[model samples]
Target: MMPNTYTQIYIQLVFATKGRDSQITNLVREEIEKYICGIFNNKGQKVMAIYANPDHVHIFFSYKNLQITISDLVKVVKTESTNFINEKKLCVNHFTWQQGYGAFSYAKSQKERVVNYILNQETHHEKKSFRDEYVEFLNAFEIEFKDEYLFEFYD
Candidate 1:
């Protein structure tokens, strides 16, 4: 018998830089996005879309199999991006991502909608802060949250 072939899995991930400094500039953002895509490609993952805002990032990707955990993926993105930014001296303060990230699973049917939302993060964030946006994602996903851990994000 042959091993079971896993189905493609789509994930939406959101995370912000440490201290909410809005330090990612246009050129740096583009370079980081390109580097992220390269990382995903090497890992046998497909980055369908990506948008790196001033303070945070949004990514849509598909995995061929459940070989990697979401936490690991987040760590890779964070570490690589930080290293790249530091190497280039892109920002004044050292670039670092917050400790936590938010990832939500979506069906193939919902891909377009999620991509649109991510693409418009600049406009969406104009009316709300990243803290509020993070909470909204948690609430919408029906994930329980402790006020303690959540408040740390704002601080």
Candidate 2:
């Protein structure tokens, strides 16, 4: 009998800088994405796509670790990445993530679509503001949320 269990969970995590400040500039965006990827990989998560926008970031990963909950993993990434940015002085100001994040799950069938969406964040944001896009995701997932509880929208 096989002792291993089988499971596949795709998660897309969206988070913005504290106060939705545009601290992640083009110069450090790629480095931040790579660092975040390393954080996910260290936890044995398979990263599908990661993008760092001026004010926010989108991370798509496959979760298989039964030991760590999604919330815990996000917390680790956010905290660690914040420390990394500050330690490395990647930004002009101290770096910090907002209080909360958005975690959306997807079916295996939607993997490619989700990855494409995350990879195209730059182009997508050009047409739509992050606030609108985030609200759309909440509406699509039928998640009831109040504006006050949402990220401090600076846009």
Candidate 3:
């Protein structure tokens, strides 16, 4: 008999527009969010929550311990989503995601909290910029990041 692999992995991913530009305007944020969700769903991943802001995006998803690496998943998502957005001409100019992304894992118990955070991004951003919020996440998780690697956008 074959052995079974059991695991529950939840990830919250954050990535911004190239050059920290605010390209994901209200005009197309929802569509882009849905498109990204579709990508994860197609891979048999369960998307818990997703939010596409003016300058960045937050996605919480369930990863079922697939053969693919996390970096590969993020790369495909960014590449394919950029291609989809550009092909649809969602923006006046070309659009691209930043080269680097922030991915943090969480316990299943914290899923609801993470989902609420992603869902209430609009209100949260009203109080603080995404840059600060992201930095906070890095700090909270004790992940060391160089200044240059971090996304900076003056909103």
Candidate 4:
């Protein structure tokens, strides 16, 4: 006899441009976002929300397929997305994601709030720098990280 297993997991993945270059210009933000969304969808991951600002990206998804680890998922997302941006000529300069990313887990109850937060990245960044906001998220989630180890961001 064969048996089936099932599981559910939710994650909010955040990453930045190499050096936080703010290279995801308004010109190609939507295109890059759609591309990234397609990657997640193609992998059968359900995306709750996705947002790409000039320097960073926020993705909230359900990791229904445990076959892939967070590290593997991030690597693929970054590599494929970078190739996509370059292939599409989305930017005058080459595009690449930073070396590290932030993956935050949340209860199902917090889904809506997280979605709204991702959707409002533009508005939120007007008031708080990405660095401050990133730090706030780390603190909120109680993740231990050193400032130097964090992604490089331009002030």
lDDT of each: 0.82, 0.93, 0.90, 0.90
List the lowest-lDDT window of 10 residues for candidate 1: 146-155
**Model 3, CA-based lDDT:** 0.90
Q: Which lDDT value does model 4 have at 20? A: 82
TM-score of each: 0.89, 0.97, 0.95, 0.95
Best by TM-score: 2
Q: Judged by lDDT against the true structure, how good is candidate 4?
A: 0.90
lDDT of 1 by residue, 60-146 (tens): 988764687778877887898789889989888888887787788899999899888888877887898878888888999999988
The best candidate by lDDT is 2
Model 1, C-alpha of 114: deviation from truth (Å): 0.8
- Residue-level lDDT of model 3, residues 29-59, one tens digit each, is 8999999989898777889999998889999
The pairs that clash in candidate 3 are none
The 10-residue segment with the lowest total lDDT in model 4: 1-10
lDDT of 4 by residue, 91-124 (tens): 8788888899999999989989999999999999
Model 2 agreement with the true structure over 56-136: per-residue lDDT tens digits: 999999998878998999899999999999999999998899989999999999999999999998999989999999999
Q: Which stretches of candidate 3 lie over 4 Å from their true place?
A: none
Q: Roughly what TM-score does model 2 have, to 2 decimal places?
A: 0.97
